[model samples]
Target: MKIYETAGFPNPARIRMALAEKNASDAVTFVPVDVMAGEHRSEAFRAKNPDATVPYLELADGTCIAQCTAITEYIDGSFDGPSLTGRSPFARAHISMMNLRAENGLLNAVADYFHHATPGLGPDLETDQCAEWGEKRKAVATKTMSYLDGVLAESPYVAGDAFSVADITVFAGLAFADFAKVDIAEELTHLHAWRARVAERPSVAN
Candidate 1:
């Protein structure tokens, strides 16, 4: 299998982290896709992923998988280490719910604030509307963070005591949030501790 992604330190890092957890990184080839040079926007890249996104996976036979969620799910199901999603139906549903909530509620908002607002990334350099939208989206992100903090306080992981795929999804998103300078409240003690734990994991650090 081959994974095509940008060289820099965002979503690709998350995928790498996941692969490390599964002991699959050594098994797959890494293909660096340049985003800064608009290589992903090129016709060749689009042929692999119409969305022109990074962290795309190509199977050995030549099947391309787009989106982080889909790729992660595939890896989780295919590998035989620890099950990240879950072993039960209830666990799967709960993990999926938490993952979706984090992606839509927190991750997207953080991206709206950072990628859209920041000037370094193409479209952000062209206008102030992105900045304006970023500022507005920040409020929603704050609310989502607070909610997740509370959830983390009650449960060891995002879904429950067991570390699941939802934990990876949320962790990756929050890591992105950290890069964007979106601060989680100091009052979120549980979340702060949980973040520390996740960071300490070999997979995450790898």
Candidate 2:
């Protein structure tokens, strides 16, 4: 398998963390895609993923999988390591629910603020921005941080007592917030503590 990604980017980092957690890092070859250079928009690259997004996974037979969640699911399911999504039916459903919540409320909101409000990537890439909407989304992301803090206060991880993909989503969201200059309030102590613990994991630390 060949994984195309821009190293250090938040979405790509999520997939990378999943790969590391699954202990399947060696199962695929990492191909660096230069998003800053607009390589993703090229026809050749677009043929693989019409969405023109990075952190794409291509199977040995040429099947391409886009989106971080889908790629993470593939990694966790196909590998022979401890599952990152969940082992049981209830666990899987809960993890998926929390993962979607983190993605919609935090990760996507921060991304909107970055691409619409700020000079994300550059003027060439960030056209048709809406600062007003971006500001609203920024506020949404901030509120989500508080909500997540409360969630962490009740559980060891984002989904439940065990580490899962939902935690990965929240971790990536927080990292993206830093890049976008969005601050997590100091009052969100539980969230901060959760982040500190997650950071200690080998998958996240590396």
lDDT, candidate 2, at 114: 95
Q: Per-residue lDDT of 1-206 in model 2, one digit per residue for the tens?
A: 89999998989989989999988888889999989889999999999999999989999889999998899999999998778889999999999999999999999999999999998889989989999999999999999999999999999999988899999999999999998999999999999999999999999777
TM-score of 2: 0.98
Off by over 4 Å in 1: 120-129
State the lDDT at 47 in candidate 2: 99
- The lDDT, on a scale of 0 to 1, for candidate 1 is 0.81
Instruction: For model 2, state the Cα shift of residue 179 in Å.
Output: 1.1
Per-model TM values vs. the true structure = 0.92, 0.98
What is the TM-score (0 to 1) of candidate 1? Answer: 0.92
The lDDT values for all models are 0.81, 0.93
Model 2 misplaced stretches (Cα beyond 4 Å): none
